[model samples]
Target: MTLKPARGLAVLLCVLSPLAFAQADAVRKPDPNTRVPQGVIHHAATGFPDRIVASPLQAGDAGFAVSWRTSPAVDAPMLEIVVAGDSPDMGTPRQVSSRTQALQTENGDARYHHAVIDGLQADTLYAWRVQGDRTWSAWYHTRTAPAAGAPLTLLYFGDTQNQNTSLTTRVIREAMRHAPDARLALYAGDLVSGGDGEDDNEWAEWFEANDPLTTSMVVAPAPGNHEYFEEFEDTPMERRVLGAHWPLQFALPANGVDEAKETTYWFDYQDVRVAVIDGTSALDLGTAEAQARWLDGVLSGNPRRWSIVLTHQPFHSPRAGRDNVLMREHLLPVIKRHGVDLVLQGHDHTYARRGADAAPTPVFVVSVVGAKQYRLSEQARATMRPVGEDTQLFQVLRFDGGRMRYEARTATGRLYDAFELIDEADGKRLVEVTEGRIDERRCDREATLKGRKDRCWE
Candidate 1:
């Protein structure tokens, strides 16, 4: 197979350069000592062939759900949850209960499967695993939400499309290095390249890229523009492939808008209410009325101290001059009234941060982890306090007591930017990080010239 570099990682064809490819292929084989294969793709054994994933881990609470896939579409994958206490002799977790249900793929593949493991104890570490007929995955452990009022921590990532398997892994692994047990992970969308309309391999590369972290971590994903596939009623290939794979891989809260478009939903953690909206549906298709209504309900009804909104498009764009002004026109007021703390997004393929102000000035961020590059927009430079044109980065947000600190770091652990969002109910204070010299250009309209100029004051 001939392969080309997308984001930044050099793609190696399985057949190209026979000697090198052969050596690389030799490493992907399942090892007796390793938990997962290095290179070969592994079909989730416990759930559908697509996903053997754990998600919706109740934040600041002690409960979570484990969803997986099974071949031949079994009734349910066996779930074993064991709470680890002080005693080292807890041995292995015994079988608790199971759910038998059919997972229907949006594209009409009935072979899909799903199950939720609920009602586990709180603030405790639990060892669990999924089991199918001929395949039983190795046991893994997860820490539930600390407590209802306890401070929470999460990792935020924007776009990881394009050269996913190569550059994406570095950023993800770096985030874990900063905080391995981050309670939650947020995505601004465009998790994969080759838009939902075509480029099936990008999806595979995406799954392959994040397999290291997602297999054990809980991630909340919102759809980005690239996730949308242009298709008429007659042939919706993108929806079929991406849709079938998304639900199969990640188990999200089934609770969402009655009339909202697909995969748009909301779920609450201890003191936080997180809502994910399908921006593409709302912006391009004009079919997100139900979603808008649902957002209203979630925000109006939510009683959490913090409400964070996730979408693929950014409200305060550093690029495209906030091209999604239509989206802002509709949802901005709702967010303003509801007191949303953070607005996470992707699509710009760069890193940006704005001051947190009381006038519904939510901290809008656009960071990309993939290898794709884009010129920094003039508006982004003029508006955002800090914007990077050529950096691959991820962010870590830690909520410890009354103070919330957000740190953005490069794949190599250099601090790119930082901010503090205090929950005074009044607003968060702005703290600029000047650890590194940011003497880089603000905007390079000719995508090729981005980051090649110097404009920052020394």
Candidate 2:
């Protein structure tokens, strides 16, 4: 079941090698004015896969998708899978072919390979590996989604966009320590600070920081404004487009609006239906109506007991001028009509939660996980409850028979907020579950006088 590189790539490489070598020799003098194309320094193929990731393709069908990166030499990428038993070697491995896409980054040209493994038994643990030209990646294990009505837990993160990956990495690792059994890691976009998604260094740092976690835990991501910005000195802000590397990096489900398939998709894990919407497209690309129609169809046909929506921009912005009025005006009603239980969003760089004033149908939340911080606008403060500024946080959600418990914790793992949703015979209701949460973190005169300047809001 081994895959091979396309003949075209081989031919192109062969035709260009001699000229490339000659150019390299001539450039040895290293003229300061001389310019070299990015990703020109190619590395020799090591015959090993790197940056392996597993994601959900179709939860209803128990399908999981795997993707990894390998050197250019390994044209045909392959995946080996087996059901786990008491020992790692207990089951016979099944080898499957994969689809590979070649991409040129600032470092060099590499191929990203993807494969979707279906017919997996729910709640079963599976061991898998990726094959390089010379060797196979070490076997990694992941568990499939459990049956409906079964209790499940997931980790939620906001924007991880930062100048460096250290802060996001630290927070992710800390979160794993608390919910090690979490089935999936859900992100509300802005995975990197790359304005145009062309910075190879930033992408490398992000992937390196989340290597093994991504290999096992399924990642559900939405696209943020940062993910859409293009990095160009002459390109005006309005001319920015979606990052070029986005579609190449992650293999997400394609069940979304035709124009924004990968960025806008949905998957159901057990009884919870999670829909990721592309807020950037809705706001900037004039794709709002199409997405809205697609969303209505998705919601109308959803059979899951509980529905959760994930988007980059909040319906109610936590920052005054940052409000996504377009999203709120167009998509909010659809969400409310469908009785969405929770809406998790990012992009505000602040934390705020607002349960609908009249009902508990959709509890909206906005949070940040990166080092960047923003003040809670006075308007936001007046609207949302328990607002926080200058903070980095992560959320853990657990769903059981008739209850869902959500906990928001600071990077240090201290509880900052808590709530519960109870689905009873009458209807679903939001209940405050914050008994031991730390006092609301805010900047005040006392804190300023005490020299804890970072705690104060701007």
Candidate 1 TM-score to native: 0.77
lDDT of 2 at 128: 86
Q: Per-model C-alpha lDDT, please?
A: 0.66, 0.80
True-structure RMSD, every candidate = 9.1, 14.3
Clashes of each: 11, 4
Candidate 2, residue 176: the lDDT equals: 88
Candidate 2, 198-249: lDDT as tens digits: 4656666667666667977798888888777644647464455787668877
User: For residue 130, what is the lDDT in candidate 1?
Assistant: 71
TM-score of 2: 0.85
Alpha-carbon TM-score of each model against the true structure: 0.77, 0.85
Model number with the top lDDT? 2
